[model samples]
Target: MTGNARSEETLLLRSAVDRLKTALPRTWTLDLDLDPGRDGTVTAVAPDARLTIRTPSGASATFTIEVKRASRGSVRGALERLLLLSDGQPALVITDFANPALRKQCEELGIGYVDLTGWVFIRNDSAGIFVRTQGPARQAPLPDGRTTATKRLDGPGASKVVRALWDVTSTTGVRELAQRAGVSAGTVTKVLPALAAYGAVTRLRDGGVTDVDRRLLMERWTLDYKIYRTNPEVLWRLAPRGPDLAYADLLATDLGNDPTGRTIAYTGWLAATVSLPEGNYPVVPNTLLSIYSADPGALGDDLGLRTASPQTANVVLIRPRDETLLTGVPLPVPEPQIIADLMTMGGRYDELATQLSEATSVRTETP
Candidate 1:
């Protein structure tokens, strides 16, 4: 075994021993057979290890696992590399970086991952453990306005394409997708390649989407969704007094199911409550109200909402990307669009985004 692969396996073994000691019952012992591979490379061969858990009573269970270090910076590259690995056992991706988005990608790809920082999630028939610790900030490691701002997916129009890609539930080509999304052919042309580059969309040689990688799509979309086209104008409105339903009911009366206008219907959590499935979000809607308006300046008067300190602000007023966003989609807020918006919310929304994707996505085993 090469020194790098050998050393990497030793470290992974140590982690398995440590975590399994607690996971397994009392008086149970754990042993690992790690194969660093003939070439001392993680990808040279997939015959990595066979682990066994033996109890004091001689009840033993054995399973297979592969340990590999994640190549830094390029999640797409990491996934492509992982795909080349042998499928004999579940692969454990050990990296120093514990990026939630990357973790999501690993899950979507059906690959198990663990970061050196002690964040780990692995599963097998014999035993499974799920522990999430803070991983590195690789999820958005680059500074603002760097690579993402320049990408073709960084716009509202491209978002239309993304929505169609995820929500439509039918195979589509460029022209078909463009017409379905009501976007220009150029926008679809530009975004599809970008999506394909990340392994989010599996395209035929002729470029039809046979299947979409939901994890990759969510991870990539979250990276740039907020800054994509425009930052929504935010204002907080203090709640006077009422049930949450009463508050929403007032808006419903004015909007009347039209999600766009001087004061169009709300989108994020509020919209999810009124439109999408339950348990899609982690928490109930916060006191903050998100509203979209063409004439936001005049919005406060009618809704009894007013600009307040951001901390105290309860209303979030957004400028529409275009009325198409509100009217064109079947849902009050499309699933992909909601996931993008939640990604920027900076709370437990990332988890919520994952749940929403799993709830909406169609998962099939990768070839």
Candidate 2:
């Protein structure tokens, strides 16, 4: 850590300690030891300090505190190390922001984490303490003190490049990738480093993509690119026959018939069900039929779908905001996009997304 970063971290740590003290009961006490010397057993990769929390009932718990101010990858790595500490020594990561995924990881590992924004999750059954508070989701301040906004898979260009990287297994040049994704070479150029930062794709000496962790790439995309949030949508209810018949009608529509000559493809639960082997679908019935179309109005008219409110809608027509949604991607829908849609739907759809990925051969063996 640089001198400036160290100072910032120190300030954050001190503030967090104060917040912890205020959060506890009047009788409870909290103390933070900045120079908590590490024992020989604790490797050089040690925590920053120790936080001792005392309850009114005389029960106490000392937690090894590690402060992280970077990305989710850094926090995740720290949490892994903290989890290895002896059962008696619980750990907590004080970070700038802890997204839901990282918080879930901390909870699952039986560790604790408190972000700078007052999001705290410390569950120590032994100490009879369980505390969790809500925090606003804000971008962490950079070393230069600027906040990140649109970088790292945030927009349509990122979606294009990410899909391109996932689709190809062989080492690919930037220009070629851009061509494949139907994007400018600059888009691929900008997105590759972000993917590298997330450890999603590996670049070679020539700056070409050499390997990709397909699953990690998809997960990282999910953090920034949400289907409903990114696209313009209209909800509708199909006729009395419901989604199954509508899906059939979609499949029957000729690609050549589209007035704009753009692709209209089925997605979400209905798509996953169709893609999966017969009788392999989960018990969750397919209620929502999501689709991507360049023209929602035309498609709705063609399908005879009735506009409906969100609660009663069985079909959703999303006019993709990104050209890459249909450009250079597979007909019916790209596997990664479908998987992303399923994941966003969440619940049992998450499992279905996994199965769809497997069936669709989503993984390209990294070289």
Candidate 3:
């Protein structure tokens, strides 16, 4: 065959091999051969087996298989070079033994190799066989039957201290907490406030500290336990959906009250108009809309409640006693004098809405 024709054939074989590499997993290897022969056949040989295909031009390609041992690194390097230099041509890797290290390296590198009984094949060229030797296997069972599954923990002294604090709080006294926690009293003293800030513990007036609240502690502990037990990637799927507005407000208030003392205020007008069926609308009917604010203190003052549009006046406060409509509980409207006072302070909703929208947008964009 002419040099040009051989090159073209090599390119075709490389393209075919590239497709094979993508289709097969790291465990499989491929070998190809193309040679002009008297009988015009192309043959590929893998470990323990060989296949032959008749060629249209009476030319034949033959492949010979050899077994070599290899380390994971060597096998991976060989595969990478083959894939890059072969121009997509399929080459073969021949190994004498199944080297676990080599297999691991191939898996890590996403390189493909085939293990055939006692030999391995990695393909990089259409015709040649390359052999590389590997070392003896170091196989031993783990003492505790446990594998290293996660990255190492790197924080300094904090986790140990936290665990100790947990034990102390779980029990009762500061001295016992200190001893069991394996830390000095001073360390405990310093960590107690930090723990309290995280709502992990509470400080008592009598110079003792304990867990802040049992329910809150238990809930957080449970969450932490689950996260530790499962993979971190799956934690979000197991988290709970909380009350939307109330949760947001609590988060905002907590951020504001931090050491920075930065007050984050939210002001937004939430207007909902329900259109009744034809003729079903009530004339001048009293409507009660429950309003909640992250900063309840700012609702009337900073929220600009007095300057709100008249349309917002439709919302009125309902007494808890009359909340159940079917019970015939008397409407708990305040006396006329109190209503007059509220009307005078109703216009602040718009200003509050503007502030809230801006604050919320800023908070949302923080990350």
Candidate 4:
């Protein structure tokens, strides 16, 4: 580490330890010792600092502490490095911030962590001391004066990457994923880390996506995405025929094969009715037929759909927020997107989400 960098890390560690001391019970005593002799070159051998804690009864324990100032996406890697650096001793990781997922990982690994946001977790069996605290659910600013923003899967680029993940089960390369998602490599680069943080996808050391948890990904996606809210749509009733006949007409239209070069597909309730087994979701009257289209005006005209009030509308011509929704995705959209759309509707559709999740969450073995 450079002299300035080491000095900054020292300051961070001291500030975090001070916060820990303040957060401790009145009866507890806390002391910090910086390992000045260790050059930090072989960080795997020596921790950045050591913490000594004592109870009123004089019971005490010492914990090796490693201070890391990392981005939110690197929290897991920081935790894992702390584990290696601490060996089998009682250890703690002090970072700029630690989200609940990373905190839970620390607890599961039986290690301790403290963050600048006042979040802390520590336990020592011999000392009979357990400490855990929660600060605000926000990231502190970096030394360079930038707030670490959490990545979200709500945007069109992220949506494309997410849908690509749903289609493949094998250990997929990032470039391959970009190609598969029909997005730029940069979009995949930004989205993968966020997806990993959400426990949706696992990445190898070389940054290849090795696994995907479709159910978890779908659940997390719904937290940020909504069918009606994320995508723009205009309500229209399909002539005088009901949604079924209209959906049938939609199938016959084969918009994917159109020479006009517009991408289109079914989604939500109407898509679920076709994808799910018969009777899994009954096609009741007035069920919304959601169609994603590149050009809603042209698609409505092509399909002979007319604008109607929400009460009378049986079909919705949706202009997707980005072409990612339609590009490279299967006709009728992917099952996960269908499930997400159902989840966005809430109410009775929540049950359909669960049913679709159970029906399609089968993983194919990676060769």
For this target, which candidate reaches the highest TM-score against the unseen true structure?
A: 4
Tell me how far the alpha carbon of residue 45 in candidate 4 is from the true structure, in angstroms, after superposition: 1.5
lDDT of 2 at 34: 78
Q: Over the stretch 1-367, how does candidate 1's per-residue lDDT look in tens digits?
A: 6988678777866775575455445666777766536446655456456556666656555444545433223565555655566344455565544455457777787666555545566555444433344443332223655532125455778778888887544577878888888888878776765565455665654656766767677666665677223555555565565326435655555643435545454566665555445544445545545565555555655666655675666656666665555452223566677777767765565555665666555332323
Q: What lDDT is obtained when candidate 3 is compared to the true structure?
A: 0.33
lDDT of 3 by residue, 1-367 (tens): 4887446535534543454355444544544544323344443422321223223333333333222232112343455654443334333433423445445554454333443222233332333333223332322222587421111111213333444443342435655666665556655555443334223455554435644443222222232222112211111110022223332443544533434322332211222112222333322222323232222234223322332233433322221211111122112122111121222223543233233333433543468
RMSD of each: 9.7, 5.8, 24.3, 5.2
Over 4 Å off, model 3 = 1-78, 84-111, 114-242, 255-367
Q: State, as a TM-score between 0 and 1, how close model 3 is to the true structure.
A: 0.19
**Overall lDDT per candidate, in order of appearance:** 0.58, 0.71, 0.33, 0.73
Better of 2 and 3 by lDDT: 2
Best-first order by TM-score = 4, 2, 1, 3
List candidate 2 stretches off by more than 4 Å.
38-46, 57-59, 70-73, 80-88, 108-110, 123-129, 136-154, 161-229, 233-253, 257-260, 277-279, 282-289, 300-316, 327-330, 343-367
Please give the lDDT score at residue 280 for candidate 3: 35
lDDT of 4 by residue, 1-367 (tens): 7999889898888888878887789889988889733654644356678888999989998887777654333556766777777678888888766655567677898888887778888999898998888886545445686435346667988888888898777889889999988889999888776556555666786778877777667866776788778876655655568777876776677776677766787787766767776456543333677788887788777778887876677787787776656753237777778888888864577777777677665323323
* Candidate 2 lDDT, 36-88, residue by residue in tens: 66455556555677888888898988998877643423445667677654344
Best by lDDT: 4
How far off is residue 28 in model 1, in Å?
A: 38
Per-residue error for 158 in candidate 2, Å, reads: 3.6
